[model samples]
Target: MTELQDTGLRRRADDAAPSITDLIDEETVQSIAQEAWSALVGEDEFLVPLPGDLPEDAVSSWVDVRGPWNGTVVITTGRSTAEQLSRELLKEHAPPVLDEEDIEDGLGELANVVGGNVKAVLPGPSALGLPVVGDAPVAGPDTCRVDLLWRGQSLTISVQGTAGALLDQ
Candidate 1:
């Protein structure tokens, strides 16, 4: 191949993949935190990693993207935190009171709102699955976690929820 062609190939190789720092860079974290906090808790604060004591009843909502970029974004929070959110968000409803069903709904909405905001900045048109709630932290491959603390309550958001093909991507 000609020198010009070789140089072009080398440049492409150099820029072939996203760096680790670039993957979970400040911009991505800050932006997601901004959108999620504003939608859920009214504002965003200094977000830190998972604390020593993570609250129980933590729920996670995730969506799987199957195109150019593949992975999932899962939003998590304590059950109590979710309850507070239940009251806060449910105010828009007619009665403004939450029940067991409402808590599930609230969890979905929490995941949707947070995931939607994150999805907006992500690549494009990927299948965002329904939010999933459980007793433990959701784990996946190549995940970048953004745990949160709001009003003395702790919450978390897990990016990249595929154990097999997560970290590499």
Candidate 2:
């Protein structure tokens, strides 16, 4: 009879991919957003934990986080709300009439700030990608989403793993 060798390596389960839910929770995400808003938008600005209907012309800004768990942090709201946010972000520097570029830049900055904070809370040594503005990426099963209202306007924040990340696991 031959003795079997003891290999230290262990097999990983097929569903071993880390999910957003496992890394962070909705309340944490909301807190992060609230802090970002207070700093960028205004000290008195608040993000109410409530759901509202998103308008037809909804826009999104997002940043990708790459690390042990890869995913995107996205913020979505109506175009009008975005414009209002841009104005608030600009504050004293805001022009009477904001152009498209202004709106996009403001929204992108908000995403970058929120995404950076989210990245800090996750398992790191993670790299944060530059913010992108457009339609939001489709969220996967491994996601933590938060619905919020700012000034009674609908807004949402989602931390979701990419489809490729899920497939690679």
Candidate 1 residue lDDT tens string, 1-169: 0011233444243354543334443347556665665666555444455443565556655555554345566666766767777776655662555676667667667667666655554433555666655554345564566656667667666666433211222
Q: Write one digit per residue (lDDT tens) for candidate 2, span 81-152.
A: 999999999999999999999999999999999999888875537889999999877655547789999999
lDDT of each candidate versus the true structure: 0.56, 0.84
Clashes of 1: 5
Runs with alpha carbons beyond 4 Å of true place in candidate 1:
1-15, 19-23, 43-52, 92-97, 136-139, 162-169
Q: Could you tell me how far off, in angstroms, the CA of residue 32 lies in candidate 2 after the best superposition?
A: 0.1
TM-score of each: 0.67, 0.83
**Best lDDT among the predictions, by candidate number:** 2
Clashes of each: 5, 0
Could you tell me which 10 consecutive residues in candidate 1 have the lowest summed lDDT?
Answer: 1-10
